[model samples]
Target: MKTLDLLRLKRRQLTTLGAAVSLAAALLPGTLHAADAASAPEPADPHQWLEEVLGEKPLAWVKERNEASFKVLKARPEFEPLRQDLLGVLNARDRIPGVSRMGGFLYNLWQDEQHKRGLWRRTTLAEYRKAEPAWETVLDLDALGAAEGESWVFHGAQCLGPSYRRCMVNLSRGGSDAQVSREFDTVSKQFIKGGFELPEAKSQLTWLDENTLFVGTDFGPGSLTDSGYPRVIKQWKRGTPLSAAMTVFEGEAKDVAASVVVDRTPGHHRVFFQRALDFYSSSSFFLQGGKLVKLEIPDDVESGFWGPWMLLKPRNDWQVGGSTYKSGTLLITDLKAYQRGERKFKVLFQPTATRSLASYNLTRSHVLLSVIDQVASKLEEWDFSKPQAPRHREVKAPFPGALHLASLYDSELPRDELADRYVLYYTDFLTPDTLFLSRAGSDERQVLKSRQAQFDATGMRAEQRFATSKDGTRVPYFVIWPKGATADGSNPTLLYGYGGFEVSLQPGYSGGRGRAWLGRGGVYVLANIRGGGEFGPAWHQAAIKANKQRSYEDFIAVAEDLIAAKITSPRHLGIMGGSNGGLLMGATFTQRPELFNAVVCQVPLLDMRRFHKLLAGASWMAEYGNPDDAKDWDVIRQYSPYHNVSKDKTYPKVFFTTSTRDDRVHPGHARKMVARMTELGHEVYYYENTEGGHGGAADNEQRATLQALEYSYLWQQLGR
Candidate 1:
C-alpha cells in the first residue's frame, strides 16, 4: 500500500478504537433525557416539553437557567469591566454612520447609549462630508416604542423611489423576524393615517408604483412555508384592503421561502420574483407583460439585473454557450438579449484556487466585486457601458483584510447624483474600521470616517495558519496573538468558528471582541474550515449533508494543530460558535471532549432528528439532510450532538446561550441539551435571554451584557 494510504488506514483504526471506548461509556446507566449515542434512539424526545417557546413552564425554566448563569457570570471581577468597555464601543458616536443614498439625501439609522432603539435620520451629501453632519430625524424608535408601549426595533423601510416621498416602514417587537409594516410620508415625517399597513409576520414588500405594491406576507393559514417564511406573493393596490389583494404567485408549503424585489430604474423598471426551494437553491422569475416568466438560469444560481446587464452567479458549474463556467464565476449578459433567448455571457469575476467572488454591489453603470484572494480582500469594478461588454477595472483599496463595498447609487432611481459613488468599509483583525467614498470604476477615493482603536495592539499580531484534516484537506485559520505570548502553551486561547451556509468568515474588526478578549491578554483564533465559502462553493459543498462530518473533522484538526504547536494546551483552550457554528461546538465537544476545557454553544441546533420540525429549521435541510429520512439519518446520527451526549464520559463545562424570542433556531435546542447533560450528571451553565430574537439581544445594553457574560465565562474556564 502507498505510504499515505497506510498512514490514513492506521489513523482511522486508532480513531475507531477511541470511538468504541467512548461509545461503551456512553451506554452506562444514567437518567434518561436525550437519547444516548450508543443506545437505540428514543421514539419520543423526553425534553420536548422545553420546545414550548412561550409556554409558562418553558419561560420558568428559562428564567431559572438565566438566573443561575447570571449569579456565576456577574460575580466575575472582569464582567463589569468587560461590559462597560464593550458597551462604550457599542455606544460610540464617532463610529461611522453607514448611510443609504435616496432622494438627494443620505439616510442612516443611528443608535447609541442614548438612542438605544435607534434613530432613523437623513443628511444632505454636502453635510455628510463634514465631521459632525447635522441629521434630520425621520423616525425616533425610542419615542415611538415608548408612545406605543412596544419594544419597536427598526426593521428598515421600503420607500417608493425616483422621488422617495412616501415609504413603507417596518418595525418589529424586540428585534424578531416578524414585523409590523406601515406606510409613512417622508416629507410630513409621520405615519400616513390611512396608508398601507401590515400586521406582524415575516413579510417582503416592494413598490410596483405609487399606487401599487408587490407583497409576500402571511395572508393566513397555508400562506406561509414550512420554514415560517412567506410562501404566497400578492399585488395590492393603494386604498384597498389587504384581503382584496390579488395573488400573483404561490410557492409550495414545503418550499423554503418566497420573496419579491421591484426595481424601478427609470426605463429599466422590472419586478424580480424568487422562490427559495431550499437554503442553498432557488429559482428566479421576472414579471413580463403581467405574467411571471421564469428566468432561464440554474436553480442554485443568483440572477439579477444591474442597469441593462443581467448578472448570474452560479453556486454550481454552468454549461452554456459551448463553455463551462466554473462555480463561483460571475457572468453577465444583456438583459433584453437573454430574455429573447440568447445564451452568450461575459465572465466578470472568475474564481481560481486562491481567489473567489466574495460579494458584489451595483451602481447605475457598474458592479463592484469584492474578491477574496486566499482569505484577503480586494475590489474590482465592472463598467457595463463598455462597447465590448462591461470593462473590468481594479478598484484600489487596503488589502490583507475585508473590504465591504456598498453603492450609494439608487438603482431604482436612475436620475441620481450619487449614481457613480460607493462606500468602502475596510477592517482587519487589529485595525479599526475605516469608511471611504469613491467613484465607481475609479481610484479617486476619499476617507469619510475612521473609528478610534478599541484595544491596544502594540505588540499584538494576527497570522494565518493551515492544518491538515483527517481527509487530507488543508484547513486555514487565523490567530490573533497578544503581547508576550509564546509557544509554552500557557496562554489562554479563544478559538471561534462558523463553517456552514456558504458564509465566509473574514477578518473584520470587532471592537467588543477586541476589548473583551484580546485587550485582556487572551489569544483569539478564527477557523476557516470546510463548510464555509472561504475557498468558494466547493469549499462549502465538500462538507455538507452526508459529508457534514468533514466540517467537524476540520475543526478538530485545527484544535489538534493548535495543541501540537504549543500555542495553548487543552487546559487553556476555549471554543465558541453561534447558530450553525453552535452545532459545530456541540458536535466537536461531544466527539472529542478532551480537546478543550471550555465550550460556548449559542443558539445551537442540537437535535438533528427534530431540527426540520423547528421554526425555520426546515429551510436548512439542504445543508443538513432530512433526519426523518432513514438513509440520511444514518450519517446524521453519527454527529447529532444531543443524541451523542455520554453519561460516563468527561466533558468540558459548556456554556450554552439562546434567546426566548429566537424564532429561527428554537431555544429548545439549548434547553434540551442542558437538561439532558444535567440529567446525565454533567454540570453545565445555561442562559436564555428574554428578547433579541436569534441574536440574543434587543438593544446595545443587552448586546453588551451578553458579550460580557460570554467573556466572563471564557475567563473563568480558560484563565486558569
Candidate 2:
C-alpha cells in the first residue's frame, strides 16, 4: 500500500480501539482525586500539593498520563487520518488582513499568494480610485530564499518617517549575531548619507529629528561567551562621519533599552531614554522657540525586583503624541502613591491581565490605553491634566482584540470633525482583521478597508479548559477543535504550548496553524501554562525558580486529560513546541516519551548546561537559574533533556530541528542533543535549515516546505 493508504488503514484501526481504551481507562480509574495528595490540607498551596503527589521530581504524573493517553490514542483506527489532516491544515497558506494609515491613506497588507516552497507573500494595496493606481511594497522577504538555499535572514523593520518626503528603516539582521542597521532615504526616494551599522551586537534606532538620530548598542562586557548586551545610547547626525557617533546617555551599570519617547517643545527637543537598570535619563536642550528640559525618572531602591526600576519593573506609564501641530502631552501612570508590594495597578480603564503597559499611546493630556480584557477589547482615554490626579473614560468602538497599536497619526482636522474620528485597526484569533476610520468615542464606525477576506473561522469552537498540575495549580489552556468533533473523545489531537518568559500567548487567529492543522479533522490546543503572564505577575513567579517543574507537570496534565477524556489515544497523540516551548517538548518527551507517538522539537534549547553561554541565553539567566551554581545545576540537570538521555531507555519517534541562522537559541543545542540521542542507539530525525533566525525559516516557501515535511513525518509516525 502507498504510505498515505497505509496511514489511513492504521488510523481506522486506532480510532475503533481508541474509543475502547479511553472508556476502559476512565472506568478503571481508582478515583478522580487519586492524583492529589492524601494528607495535604484541604486548602494547601497548590505547589505543596503537587510536591506531595509528584514527589520531589513532580514529573511522575506526566509519565503516567503519557502512557495512558498514548494507549487510548493508539487504539483508534482513524488516528492516522486525523493526524495527517492536522498536519495538512498547518501546511496550507491562510491569509490575514493587516492595515496601516500611511501618507494620509489607509494601506492594507494581505496574504497575496503561496510563493515558491509554500511561503505566503504579504502584498500591499494602496486603495486608489484610478485603474492604474500606484502600489508601494512594505516588506518583501520573498527576496530571502528557501531555508535549503540560504544561511542568513533579515527581519523586524521599525520604519519611521518624520515627513512624507523622507523615511528611515531600522532593521535587525540575524545570522551569527543580531545586528541592527539604519537605511536612510528621502521621501522622494533618494538615498541619504552617513548610515549606521553594527556587527555582532543588537541595536535599535530612534530618530530625534530629520538630521539627528539615537542608536542604542549592546556590547559583551566580559568574555564574549559569558557577556551580555550591556547597552549605551549614542547620537548620530546626518553630516557626521561613521566614526563620529557621540554618546548621549550612559547607564551606571548594565542598563538595557526599556523604552524611548521623543518630544519636541516650542524651543527645544527632548528625548526620554528609559534603561532596564532602574534609571530613566532624559536629554533636553533649547530648541528654536522653547527651552528643552530633560527629566530622569528616578528608580525606587526598595522592593528590589518589584521596585520602581525601569528595566526590572516599570512603575510609570507615559503617553507621547502631538496635535494638529505635532504637539502632545505626556501622561504617566502613577504607581508611587499605591501601597508598594501590591501586584496590581489601578488605571483609567480595566487593564487586561495578560497585556502590559506596552499597548498604549500618550498625547499631552489624553492617554490611549488598549485593554484586551475578557469580553471586550477596547482603548481607554485618560486625561492626565492634573499630574497628581488623573481621570479616565472609556472610548467606545466596534473593534475588539485591538491588542496591537501601529501608529497614532496627528490630525489637523477640527475637533468636531476629528475628535470623535479616529483610525482603529485590530485582529483576533477568529477575525481576519479590519481597519476602520471612525470616531473613538462615537457610535458610528465604518470599515475603511480589509485584506484577505478569504480567511474564515466558521464552525470553529474555542474552549478554555483548566488542568490541575501535579502541584494542584489550575493551568488554563485554549483548545480549538473542529465543529463536528465528538467531545466523548476519539479525535486526533495536537497539543501545543509555549510557557516561558512573561509573554502571554494571546488568542490570535493563525493561518499557518489553523488552515494547515485544525481545518481538517485535528484538534489544536494551546496550553497557557505557567511562567507566562496570563493571570498576573504572581502567576509567573509561581512557576519560576526551583518550582519550575510545575510548568512541565501542568503540560502533562493537559495531555493526560485529553486521553482520559477520550479525545484521542496515545498512539495518535503528538506534541510540538518551539523555543522555550522547545524546552517544554524536551522535558515532556524525556519524562513521558510514551505519552506521545511523535514529537517535533524545533530550535530547542535541550542543553541546559551551556544554555546561558549561547546567544541571548545569558540575558535570560534571571528567568532560568544559573546552571553553573551547584544548587541551581542540581535542579536544572534533573530536567535537562540533553543531559538525561539514557542508553537503556527507548524514546518515541523524535524529530530534532533547528536553523543554522538561529542565533537566539544556538543550533548547537539541537545538534548536540541529536548527536547524543543518535549515539545512544535511538532513532532521531535531524533537519537543520540553513536560513531563518531563532524562528525556523526565513521565507514563506521555506516555511511551507518545512511544515509539509514536518507534517508528513508526524503523520507517518503517529497517524499510522
Candidate 3:
C-alpha cells in the first residue's frame, strides 16, 4: 500500500480501538462509577503526563524514536539527494576570484588551484604595466602558514608607512576571544622582529602610525556576565605593557575600530574612530593629530540604531558610508559640524516607505544611492549631486525573485578621471550574485563578474500575498514556487517565518532551502508577520510583549490561507522556525494543532515563564515582558505554549531539536516541552545536538545531517 493509504488505515484502526476501549470501560460497573470516571483534574504537573504515556523515562523514549527516525531517514535515497545539493551549494564558490588594490599593488584573493583553499596574492601596478589588468598573487595565505580556521587573516593586515611600503600583519586565532600576535613587515613577503602578543583579547587592532598603534582592551574588573551586549572598549598604545594599558576613551561603546583616510589635499589625514554598543548605535569621530576633532556622519543614518559599519570616508566636507540599523531604514548622513557637546547632521537621501536603502557612496561631485523598494522588489539608483533636488533614476532590479545589496567598491581611479563610474554588486533569492560597472551620464552598465553563472534560476517564481489575522490585521508573505508548477496548488508547502525583534525576513539566496525543499516538488513561504520589520519598527513593537500572541495568530492565518487557497492541504503542510521563530512554531502548534501536519522547532524559547532566567533572555525582557510581574504574567500565561498543553487535545507530530551548546536559549526549554507533551499523551520526536551554540549543529556536515532529518520528518508526517 502507498504511504498515505497506510497512514489512513492506521489512523482508522487507532480510532476504532479507542472507541472499543471506551465502550468496554462504560460497561464495567466499577470503572464506569461516577467516582472512578470523574473527569480527572488536569494534570497538576503537565510534565508528569509524559511519564504516564511514554513510560517512566520520557527522554529515553525520545532518544529511541530519534535514533529510529535517523536510521530510516539515512537509508532513504531521497535523503542523499538533499545532502548532495547541500554539498554542491557550499562548494559552488570554491575557485572564485576577487580583485582589490592595497599597498601600491593590485591584490587578488582566489581559491588556490591545487588545494582549493582561499589564497591572497599581490602584484605591483608597475609590474603589470597596464592601466586595467587582471590581478596576480604576491602574498598567498598558504605561504604564511596560518593555521586552519583563521580565514579572517586578510582583514588583519594594515599599511604602516606614508609611502604605503611597510605593512603590519596581526594574526588572530579563534573568533571573539582571539589571541592576536602582531608582526611588522616592511615588505609583503616577510615579517619583522620585536612583535607583540595580546592574550585573551576580543578587540580588533588599528594602526595609528609606524610606531603608534591602537589596541582595544575590555574593562569590567573582569569578564562581563551579559552576552548580548558588547565588552567595554579601552584603548592601549602599542608600546605600553599589557598590565599598564591606559584608558584613552571608554564609554558604553563595546568594540571599536579606527581608520585613517588621506584628505584630498596632500599631507592631511582624517582619522575616524567608529565605536559600537551592543552591536548597534555606531558613531564615528574624526581624529586629527591623535586628538578627537570632528565626528563623521555615516552615509546611511537615521538613528543610533545604525550598525555593521562597512566603511568611512571624508567625502568632500561630508563623510559617507552604508549604515543599517533596525533593518528597513537606510539613510545617508552629511556631517555638517562635529565638536564637543555640539553635533550637526543631515540626511542626504532617504528612501520612502516599503523601500530600503541598499548602497550609498559619494564621488567628488555626486552621490550614488541604491534602494530596494519592497513593494515591487525593484532596485533604484538616486543621484544626489544637487543635494537640494536629488533625482532618482530607476535601474533594473538586479534579480527578479528578490534583490539584496551585496557590496560596493569605490573606484581606485582619481575622482575626476572616473567621473560617474562605479561598481554595484547585487544578488537575489533565486539569482546568482553579479557585479556590474555603471558610468556616469550613461545608462549602459557592463558586467564585471558573476559569482554563479552555472546555476540555473530560470523557473523560480516569487509572489507576495497578504493573509488576514484573527484581529483583522493584514500580514504579508512571500511565496516561492518551483518552475513549471501547476496552479492546482497540490504541491507540499513549507511555510517559514520569524516575526519578532524588528527583524525583516528579507528574501535572499538560500541554496539549501531552494534546492532541497523547493526543488523537490514543494512550496516555500516566508510570512512577513507583525513582529518583523517588514513594514517598520512600529510593526515589530505592535507584536511585542503583551501583543506577542498576535505574531502567532498571524502565522496561523498564513497557514490557514495557504490551505484555504488550495496551496496545500493540512496533510501536506509543514512549518519550521528557529529561536524567536521557534516560539512562533510552538504557539502555533499548540493553539491550532490540526492546522499543520509537522513542525520543526529548533532552540525554541517555549517555557515563557522562565525564559528571562535563561541565557540572553534577560535582555529580551524588552521584547517579551518579564513574567515575574503580575500584570505581565496575566498576558504571558494566556499564550505560553508550555503552560497551555492540553491533555485532552491531540497535537500535530512535532520534531523538537536543540543543541546542548545553545547558551543563548537553554536546551531545557525543548527538553521540558517534549517531556510535558509526551506525558500529555502526545507523540513528539526530539533531537538534541551536543554542539553549535544557539544554532544547534556545528559543522556543515552536521548541519546538512540535521536539515536532512528535519525534512525527512516533514516528509514522513506530511508527504505521507
Who wins the lDDT comparison? 1
Candidate 3 differs from the real structure by a C-alpha RMSD in angstroms, to one decimal, of 12.0
Clash count, candidate 3: 12
Worst 10 residues of 3 by lDDT: 14-23
Where in model 2 is the C-alpha error above 4 Å?
1-134, 137-161, 164-166, 171-177, 180-182, 193-201, 218-230, 252-261, 265-268, 278-346, 349-358, 363-366, 372-407, 410-431, 450-459
Cα deviation at 6, candidate 2, in Å, is 48
Name the runs in model 3 displaced over 4 angstroms: 1-69, 93-225, 252-353, 356-368, 381-392, 406-423, 426-430, 439-442, 451-460, 483-490, 607-619, 626-648, 658-682, 686-699
Error of 3 at 101 (Å): 7.2
Colliding pairs, model 1: none
lDDT to native, each model: 0.83, 0.52, 0.56
In order of appearance, the predictions have TM-scores of 0.94, 0.70, 0.70
- lDDT tens string, model 1, 339-365? 788898888889999899987888777
- Reference-based lDDT, residue 228, model 2: 41
- By lDDT, highest first, what's the ranking? 1, 3, 2
Q: Candidates 1 and 2: which is better by TM-score?
A: 1
